[model samples]
Every structure is written in C-alpha cells, then in structure tokens.
Target: MHRARADCTANTSDPVDGQAMHRARADCTANTSDPVDGQAMHRARADCTANTSDPVDGQAMHRARADCTANTSDPVDGQAMHRARADCTANTSDPVDGQAMHRACADCTANTSDPVDGQAMHRARADCTANTSDPVDGHAMHRARADCTANTSDPVDGQAMHRACADCTANTSDPRIVQQCKEIVLLVLLTPVILWVVKPCTGLVLVVLLTPVILWVVKPCTGPVLIVLLTPGIPG
Candidate 1:
C-alpha cells in the first residue's frame, strides 16, 4: 500500500512540470516578437520625420533667395525706364539718337506756311536790311571807297612811297633810289594834272599841301643830289 501511493504522487508531479515548461516557452516567444515590432515602428517614424523636415526647410530657403534676388534688381530696372523717359522728354519727338531736336527744328522751318512764323522771319530780314542801310554806315563806306581809290591812283606810285622820306636818298647808286627820284620829278611836274583827274577839291587841296612837307621830310639831302644828277652831265 505504501509503494502504490508513492508511484501515484510521482505521476502527478511530472504533468505539472510539463505544463510549467510550455508556459515558459510561450512567454519567451512573445518577448522576442515585441522587441522586433518596436524597432520596425521606430525606424518608420524616423524616416517619415526626416523626409518631411528636409524638403520643407530646403524649399523655404530657396524661396527666400529667389525673393531677395528680385528685390535687388528692381531699382536697376526702374532707373533704366526713367532714363528712357527722360530722353524722350528732352526731345520734341521720341528721342532715338543724337540730333533729334535739331531735326525737329529743321522740319518746323520747312513747314512754315503758318502766317505767324513767316511774319517773324520777314521781320528778322527787314531788321538786317535796315542795319545795312543805316546812314552813318553808308557815309563811312563811301569815305572808305574814295580813300582807297585816291590812294591807289596817287601821283606818287606805290614803289616810290617809302616808309620814311629819308629812306629815299639812302643810296644814290641804288637802282631803287633812281626809280624813286624819277617818280618824284614826274610828280612835281604833273601836280595840276592829278588835281584835275582826282577832281575832289578837298582831296586836291590835301595833296597839294601834304606833298611838299612829305617830300622835304623824305629827302632833306635831295637838293644837292638832284642838282648833280639831273643837270647836264654832272658825274653821278
């Protein structure tokens, strides 16, 4: 009876031990599965956060730089527009190149069928004529003309008229002096003929009076020289 009781107790202990081993194996498998699932979820979250934040930040920076570039270039464009408008304002027409205003003014002149513009041009021409016909200017012109004519045809030719009368008798042997002496002698003989031809009484009187003073001043040594040369066969 004691042996039978011992064997029954052993059989009960073996079944209980088998059930405990199955429960332990199940707990270990669940623990391992839990860790793998947690790791996979963590990696998915990390990938999603990185993808979202990187594109958002990069796009924001790109937009800011584009806006900055546009703002910086605006004033440069405005200045170019203003300069073009200023050129147009300065010209009578749209300013294309140099001489635009001058060309416009020339065209305005050509199309002057307008009475007011024609009258203005006429008045300018009349004023020019009046200035030319002023009595004072006319009288001065006449006097100048008379003087030039008389001086040109004077009894003393240009070659004989020295800067100073003393220059005339500078050298008796000089051919120039000989020519001058002949002109002077001819002038003395033909004084009356010159007065008649030039015919202005005032001019004649000035010639008559100025001639002797000029000759005397020119040739203070003339009397002796002329007596020796002009008189019969005196040695030169």
Candidate 2:
C-alpha cells in the first residue's frame, strides 16, 4: 500500500496492490485527507493523482503531463499513454520499439521505405512497387525490370573527351611513360564507344579517319600530343 502526508501537490504511481494508506513517490506531494491518504506520485514530470475509487489504469491519469495520455487504457495500466506524455503522440499505436514515434513511422510506412530516416525518401530495394517514381541512384536494382535508368550519359561528349585527353597528356613527360602510353591507348580505344552513343554517324566517320593518325602518333618516339587537342568534331 502507498501513503502520502499533508499538503501533497504532486504524486506518481500507486503501489499496484497496496490497500493501506499510500502517498505518491518520486518527489510528489499528497493531500493528507484524500482517499487512500493521497497517492500523489511524480516521476520526473509524470504526475499521478489516480483515484482508486475511479482507477485510471493503463490510461493517462489527470495531469499525467507530457501529453502522452491515451484515452483508452492498455492492459499494462498507465503505460498506454506514456509515449503521448513525452510528446510522441503522432505514432503511438504500434510504434516501432526504441525508435522515436515519428521516425519509426517514416521508416515503416507501406509506401516509402526510407532506410536512414530523413536521408533519402526512397526504398532501398527496387521490388517495392508502391512508389511510382524512378529508382534513385544507390537504390537496389529491380529484379524483373533490370533497366536502371540512372546514369545514361553520352560516352564521347566534348567535355569527356577533353578530360580523358587531359589526363592522358598530363603525365606523358613523367618517367613512367609506358603506363601513360597504355592509358592513352585505352582512351583511343574507348573514343569509338563513347562517340557511337552520342553521335553514331560522326563517331563512325571519326573512328575510320582518326585511327591511323592516332596509331602513328603513339609510336615509340613520342611526337607532339597535339592531334588529340585539335581533334575535329563531326557535324551532326
């Protein structure tokens, strides 16, 4: 049984099975004359003036404060509205355990499966068809529709070619000339593939015309790497 004395202002949970005079625990004050001798309990900010005559079990009691008071009590008694008291009433019912009520609902919502709470609002896996938008980058690929429409860039764009040539020519004068030459060779080889995607007609014509010129420039005695710098663009 719980018991409190004179002029109690705040109190917390009453002893579950106590029938004798009881007072609130956890710094709560109780009125000396109230029934059950005033069971005014307060845990932190949780105030409890639960009248046994009208037991508010599994539900928020008067001034349960924190606003986590549930109207209908749960079997657990008083804990039903614990989350609401702590300013988490948004997702109180069946909220994900241990996570904040608002965040847990975002993570578990049927439509949007956000992995890292406010980071990306898309699903981690592509199979979840609930969302109609395109699968963003870093999202898992869809099983049936393997078409990942994320990075469809033109292979041989002017900017890309310029960058590749820059990288190739930047370290040509270094002692590691062989490695540089190999990179240059790869660039030359990949030029056809990139151009084919962007401007097929122009890419093919350039490939036919520039292959011999580039091969000759790549001879053992390095000639001026000026051919790539002045490479002509085929008119679309």
TM values, all candidates:
0.19, 0.21
Residue-by-residue lDDT tens digits, candidate 2, 1-236: 33354544433334542333234444543332233324432232235433222111222134434433333333333232222233322323222233321211122332233332222222212342221212233322211112323233211110111112212222223235556677777677577779888889977787878877887766643343445433554534
Best by lDDT: 2
Worst 10-residue lDDT window, candidate 2: 154-163
Model 1 worst lDDT run, 10 consecutive residues: 122-131
Task: List where candidate 2 sits over 4 angstroms from the true fold.
Answer: 1-15, 18-26, 29-65, 71-111, 114-236
lDDT of 1 by residue, 72-119 (tens): 111222211111111111122212221112111111221111121121
The per-model lDDT (C-alpha) reads 0.25, 0.36
Cα lDDT over the full model 2: 0.36
